[model samples]
Target: MTPFEWILAVCIAIMAATLLSGLVLVLRTSDVLARAVLADLIFYTMICIFLTWTLTNPTSIGYEVALLAAIAGGVLPTLSMARIISRGRR
Candidate 1:
């Protein structure tokens, strides 16, 4: 394998580890806030995985998808958290 492939593999490994740990945390934690944050982390990790894949393969489509995923990853959870907090106050 080339050096770039090795670097990509390492990145993939790190993203996998992060995803697994985040999943474990999400499962073990009862706190809504903690779970939400972990979920967000997992989302970003997934994006990073996509970006790495795109970089190694040279695909515009993958980059576009990654961008969309990144935006959703940040925005949807934030909107959900806002709704949760607002409702909790009622």
Candidate 2:
């Protein structure tokens, strides 16, 4: 494999490990806010994995999906935070 491919592979492996650890944290946390934060971490990690895969195999369709997913990943967390805040106020 080329250097770039090797680097991407390493990054993917590290991200996978991080994702697993985040899952554990999410499961262990009793607080709603904490779980939300951890779930967001997991979501971002999955997006990273998808982007990395797309890097190795460039395709227009996949790129568009990845872009949309990344955008949604950002937006969902904000909505979740808003919901959490609104519920907390009550």
Candidate 3:
């Protein structure tokens, strides 16, 4: 494997660990706000894992999917903030 591959592997590993730990925290925590924050951590970590993977297995479709996922990922924080600001009002 090349240096880039090794770096990607390490980065993915770290993200995976973060993802798992965040999952645990989300499960154990009682506060609603804390769970919301941990959920974002888990979501973005999965996105990072996917992005790192595309580095090695480059594909045209992969880039398009990643772009879409990234845009969707942005939606999470926006909605979360909106909920927080409005205090969950419709």
Q: All candidates' TM-scores?
A: 0.83, 0.87, 0.86
Tens digits of per-residue lDDT for model 2, 19-86: 99999998888999888888888988988888898988887788787778868987878987889968
| TM-score ranking, high to low | 2, 3, 1
Name model 3 segments beyond 4 Å from true. Answer: none
Stretch of 10 with least lDDT, candidate 3: 76-85
Candidate order by lDDT, decreasing, is 2, 3, 1
**Backbone clash count, each prediction separately:** 0, 0, 0
Off by over 4 Å in 2: 88-90
1 or 2: which has the higher TM-score? 2
Segments of candidate 1 deviating more than 4 angstroms: 86-90
Candidate with better TM-score, 1 vs 3: 3
Between the candidate structures 2 and 3, which one is better when assessed by TM-score?
A: 2
Candidate whose TM-score is highest: 2
Query: What is the per-residue lDDT of model 1 for residues 2-90, given as tens digits with 9 covering 90 to 100?
Result: 99899999989989998999999999999888887787888889888888877778875886697688688777888887767676664
